[model samples]
Target: MLVGPRPLTFVAVALAAAIVVNSEAASAQPDAGTSQAAKDAARELATKGIELYHKGRFAEALEQIQQAEERYAAPTHRVYIARCLVGLGRLVEAKAMYERLGSEPRPREMAPAVRDAYGAAATELTALEARIPKVAIAIVGASTGAELSIDGNPRPLPAGPIDVDPGSHVVVVTNGERRAERRFSAVEGAKVEVRLELAEAVQEEEQGSLVPAIVLFSVGGAATVVGAVTGGLSLAKVSELEERCVDGHCPASDQDEADFAEALGTTSTVTFAVAGAAVVTGIVLAVVRPGGSSANTGAAATSAKSIVIDPVVAPGFIGVRGRF
Candidate 1:
């Protein structure tokens, strides 16, 4: 997530400088038996830190405040430290400091400067609450050994929401050899939900076996040859019957031949049509190869709109019919 720099106004700088001055001035007038040297050193560090903060040297300011904290513990220094963290774009740490300070009860003997620091912490916490974002993850059909990570840091599959800073984030889920990744941007105060479904990993069988195609081709070719022979015999019988016929009238002696020829023609037509369809289907299967693509692993689908074959039988016509 990207955070734009907040504009610093004169009023803010004046208020921060006033806190530093007031703290140093208060510590300068030490009580009897107090270690004036140690208090003076802390006051000097706090002053330097405030100068750095005003100069926009957040890193240096943070170091100075840390040094002051080491020298002398003060709630006011924590306020400066949190401000430095915000300036350095360490928002999560800054937010924690703000939260901690906001929850603490105000001390009874708190100086006006310390009271002002606590007030500032409260204000900063309110702003941070609006800037932080949250994410919720939902996994569907998560297999055993499935792992999830955010920004390369592994985390347990969360049952609830997780807070994050406003910015770009990467979410990844892995199950066995299969993996899924997504990149998303989170806006300030946004509650984003990412749903992922793990895909099962399975070995794919080889394609283009050609065994079924070969078998169908052989069966269809034999039927076609048989049908051709029957059709030729039928044609010869018809010619012989024509010779016996006069004025479209055939003698009773040719009746048996005529009936046999008709049967042969009908059988030839039916056989040819079925055989042609089988051969065509075989060729299509050889070319297409159902469930062939490596990218496709799901169950196959069936449809009714497919190739069909029928016989064409009419007066002076005997052939196969194909429809797609």
Candidate 2:
């Protein structure tokens, strides 16, 4: 949300001249090692910085002012740098410069020009503090295990109404395997609120359903049970035939029973084979949970609208039949 255009606060000619004169590079240094050449160079840099700043070439002015500060530190240099940063939309760094200037100790013998710069620093610090933007972030998930990050800088849980520079930023919230991301821009003097939610239902919905796999496994289990029952019955019939028959052949009455048992034995073998195939197929489906695959969806669509999975038995036939 763009609040409005941020205009640069123009520096009046009188104020800029006052800063260059009072910079005090040559006469005010406590160090005797400060040579006349270094002081001259510092003064020259500060003068050029003021000229560039007046023309709105803030980046070039900031470079000049920073070089001057490196050569010989002064309150005036910091004030100019802070102003340049403001012109560049870097409120946070600008606020820091003003803060540091305000915190430096003042000497009783300090020059009136230097004191004037100090007073200006204090006044600007107050305004800069108000102009620095704030961003509040909250995660609506587990109280523990969740982590929050702002522009790749990891922040602690319950991360806050944090101070930020006025610009675009990214907020990331993570809890275990779940993650959420948001992008927003912060405006000067404005507060932005962000919320992230990670829910179990959302995760479950994304990974597909387990219902189809469960159904396959249940049908496979029923087929296995039917095969086992038939196998046991066929074994019982063999034992009865062995007892009733002697030598290499069965009695006349036992012959028909023997033929029936032979058919039952064949039926048992086929039923067991079918059971094995079904159970194997069920294992495949359970391993690869269905509902998300195109092939699985197509199979489900083409399967019989009404179907049953059970052992089919009659006077002459015994087997298992069903569709999944």
- Model 1 is weakest, by summed lDDT over 10 consecutive residues, at 298-307
* Candidate with best TM-score: 2
Q: Model 2 — TM-score against the truth? A: 0.53
Model 2: per-residue Cα lDDT over 207-244, one tens digit each:
33556657756766776777677778878998988987
Report the lDDT tens digits of candidate 1 across residue range 13-81: 443443344444322222334355655676678777877887889999899878876666666677778
* Candidate 2: regions farther than 4 A off: 1-32, 142-146, 155-160, 175-177, 199-324
lDDT of 2: 0.67
How many backbone collisions does model 1 have? 2
Cα lDDT for residue 318, model 1? 51
Please list the C-alpha lDDT of all candidates, in the order they appear: 0.70, 0.67
Candidate 1 global CA lDDT score: 0.70
Residue 86 Cα positional deviation in candidate 2, in Å, after optimal superposition: 0.8
